[model samples]
Target: MLGTIIITIFILGPVGVLSQSAENNSISERIIGGHSAAEGQFPYQVSIRVNGKHECGGSIISSFWILTAAHCVARYPLGVLLVVVGTNHVKLGTPYGVAQVFVHEQYESQTKINDIGLIKLAGRINFNAKIKPIQLSTSLQPPGTSCVLSGWGFTNVQTQTIPDSLQYIGMRIVSVERCRAAISAAGLNMPVVDTQVCAFNAPGRGACNADSGGPLVCNGVQYGIVSWGNPCATGVPDVFTSVAANRKWIAIKSGV
Candidate 1:
C-alpha cells in the first residue's frame, strides 16, 4: 500500500539515501521545539561526526562502546567517522577516533527495522561527572511513558541551520497500534515492527534530520535509538529502534 502512495517518507540520517520509492527528498534532520541542554545535563550524549561534520547523535553505552542507528554508520568507513563527547556544545567536545563499527546484520534500510549499531572507540573513555555511560534498557516502557531526546541536530529544517549547542525535548511513548495508525494516516505503508517503538508529543515537536541514532531515554534508561520518522515533526509519531529488542545482539557485539 505504501507503494501506492505518491508522497515519499524520508529516513532521518545521512543525506543521499533515498526512500524505498527512490524519491529525491533528503534525509530528515534535527529536533523541533527543544530547549538548549545545559553542561553535563546529558552526559551520555555524543555527537557523531563524519568527515568533520555532525551527521548523527549517539549515546555512550560503555567506556569503549557507543550506541547509535545503523544507518548513521553503514556507508561510511571507520577512518572518516569521529565521536565527540563530554560537552553540551558540539565544537567544544573532545574528539575520539573510532576503532570499529558494527551494524546490525538484520538491518533493513528500506524499512529501517533493526536499525541499531555500535561503535567501539579507539581508546577507553575517562568517565567523570561530565562523561559517563547510560544504562541500556532491558524492557520497553509502557505506552504514555515520559522520555527525553537530546541531540545537536538542526533546529530549523527550512534553513537547515544546526545548533552549536545540544538541544533536548520531552516526549511521550506512543502505542504501537497508534504509531501504525499515524503512519498509515500519513499515507505510508511501512510496518512499525515489535522491534521498534514510537514517541511523540504535539505537532512540530519531534526528532528530525541528523537527530538519528540519538538516544530516546525513558526515566534515565536508554531505551530507543532515533531511527526514522515523519520529517520535521508534523505531529506523526517519531519511530525509534527498540533497544530492548536488540539487547542480546548488543551484548554479543559490544559486551556492554
Candidate 2:
C-alpha cells in the first residue's frame, strides 16, 4: 500500500485570529527567492489579512471578487476575514471587509486538491494605478514557461520573518512527469494530478510560508493559486491549484 503522505498545506503559519494584541513577529514571510516589487507592478495582487496583518496572498479577479487558496480561509467565518488591496506595502494597503467567502466544495485538505477559494468584498474596490483586476488563464502554459509570483511572504524559511515590502519571483512551470519523479525521489509517492499545476522554485526560488492564495501569473494572465509545497524553497516543485482547469468554477463564483 502507498502509505499516507502528510502533505503540508502552507497556511503561512499558525492560524491568525481577528485579535487586537501585539503583532506576532515570528510568522514566516511568504515568498522566498524574490525581490521587492514596485508599488503598482502587480496591480491585481491583494493581501488577505487577519487582525490587520498579512495572513495570505490573493488576487483581484474583479472589483468585488478575490481569488485565493481555500485553505487560507476555510476555517474562518465569512465576515472576520479582511481583504487589503490597492498597494504593495502590506501595512499601507486599503482594507476592505469580506462580505462572503466561497471555498470550493470539493476541497480536500489531505491531498491539497481543489484548493481554490473566492472572497466577495463588501464594496467594490475603486480601480486605480495601484489596484486592478487580472484575467484568469484559460489554458495551461507549457513546461518551462516563465511566470511571476508576488506576495509579502517570508524572505527566508529558516528566519520566518516577512519583508517590509511586497516581493516578486520569476518561476518556470515543471512538467508533471518530472514533478512526480522529484516527489518520488524525495521518498514521497504523492501523485501530481492534472488539477494541480507544478512549478519549479529551483533551489532558492519560490513561494514560502503564508504565500498560499497568491497568484501565479504567466504572460499577465493569472494561471494558478498557490496551494501547497515542500517546506520553503528547497528545490521541490511547488503545487498550485490549476486555474486553467478550474475556469468554470471561477467563472461561476466570480462571474468573470
Candidate 3:
C-alpha cells in the first residue's frame, strides 16, 4: 500500500484543459486502437453523462457517491448527472444508479484548482465483482514509482467522439523538481500549494481533454484525480490535485 501510494502521488499533479493532439484525434481510431477507460471490475469504475449525453468518465468512491473532475461539473448544468457503473460497454446496459452532480464549493473551472466534485445517487449501489468502489490512497506519491491511468478519452488529442472501449497505460511519477521545471518553463508561476503532485506519460501515451476528471489509479488504490494539463499531456505539463493532500477534506465534505 505504501509503495502504491508513493507511486500515485508521483504520477499526478497540476493544470489541464480540453485538448486536441496527435495521440488520438477521433473516436473511431481510439476504439480501433484497443484502449478504453470503462473496462475491468470495480464497484466505482463509473461514467457520467449530462442531459442524456455522455460528458466524461469518473469513479464511484461510495455506495451513493461518484467522484470526478471539477471542470466537468462547470461544463454541464445540474440537469441529469448520470452515474453509470459496472458493464464497460456504455452503449448498451442498465446503469448502477443515477445521481445529482455537485461541485466542490471552492472548485473553480478557470483556475482548475481544487478541481473536485461529487455525485449523490438517488439509490445505493449493491457491491459486486463487476461493481465495487475503487480503493482510495491516503499516501503521497514518491517520485518515479509507476502508476496506471485508465479512461475513454480519444486515442490522441485531436479526435472527436469518445471511444467505446476503455484504454489504460502505465506511467511514472514526476519528481517535484522536474514537474516544477516543466511548469516554470511554460511561464506560469509554479504552484506553491503543497497538496498537489505531478505526473506525465512515461514516453509514448498521454492524457487529453477527453480524459479530464478521470482517475490516476495505481497500486489498487486511487491516489489522484485528473484535474488539468498545460499541453494536454503534450509539451506542457499536466497536474492533479493530490488525493493524499486532501483526503480529510474529501471525507469531511462528502461525509464518507
Candidate 4:
C-alpha cells in the first residue's frame, strides 16, 4: 500500500535537485551518530566523488568494480564521477576514473526500488591491508541482526557537509512490516518492498544524508546498499537496497 510520503533522499554525488515523482523532494547528504573509523578497519569502503567532492559512499566488490546506489550515479554522466579507495580519510585515497556505470534497469527514483548500481574503474585497484573487496551477501539477514554501516558522509544533517574521516555505526535489521508501519506512522506514504531492507536502532542514531550508497555489512558480508530514509536519523527506519535480492543482476552487469 503506497501512500504519499516525504522522502528526503540523501543524494550527495549529484549537484542539483532531483525531481522524483510529484513531490519533487530535495536531496542532501550525511551520517548521524557515528564515530571515526580506524585506518584499514573498513577496507572495502570508498568515497564516490563528483567534480572532486565526496558525494556518496561505495564498496569495493572487485578490484575493477564498485557497488553503490543507482541514485548516486544515475543522473550524472561518466566523466564527472571518480572513485577513491585505500584510505579512511576521504582526501587521502587513490582515485580512479570511471569507465562505465551500470544502474539497475528497473530503478525507480520515486519509489526507490532496485536502487543498486555498479561502477567500472578505468584502472584496476591494488589490494592491500588497507584496501580490499568485500564479499556480496547471498542471503537476507533476519530481523534484529546486527550490522555495521561505514561512510564518509556528513556527521550532521544540518551542516550538510561530509566528514573527512570515515564514520561507522552499529545498526540492526528490522522486519519489512515494521519498517512499513514506521514509515506510515512517520507520515510517509512510501512502500517498503521486499527488494528493500530496513535498519534502525534508536531515534537519534541512523543513516542520514551523504550516507547514501554505502555498504551495510553483517557478519563481514555486504548485504545492503544505503538508499533513503528520514532526514538525519530521526528514528524512522533507514531503508537500503538488498544486495542479496539483486545479486544476479549485479553479476550479470559487472561479473563480480
In candidate 2, list every pair of residues with a backbone clash: 12-210, 29-153, 29-154, 30-153, 30-154, 31-153
For each candidate, the alpha-carbon lDDT, in order, equals 0.78, 0.73, 0.56, 0.77
> Judged by TM-score, which candidate is best?
1
By lDDT: ranked, best first: 1, 4, 2, 3
Error of 2 at 253 (Å): 1.8
lDDT of 3 by residue, 1-256 (tens): 0000111111222222213222321111011122444445434566666665555667778888777766666655555556667766646434644546667777654555677777778888887777778777889878776776666555543444466666666656776667667655555543624565566553334554445566777778887776655423444345666777767877876776
Report residue 254 deviation for candidate 1 (angstroms).
Answer: 0.7
lDDT of 2 by residue, 32-87 (tens): 77889977999999888876667788999989999998878888776568898888
Off by over 4 Å in 1: 1-8, 11-27
TM-score of 4: 0.90
Clashing pairs in 4: 3-189, 4-189, 5-189, 29-209, 29-210, 30-209, 30-210
Query: lDDT (0-100) at residue 148 of candidate 4?
Result: 88
Point to the candidate with the largest lDDT: 1
Worst 10 residues of 2 by lDDT: 13-22
Judge candidate 2 at residue 48 and give its lDDT: 88
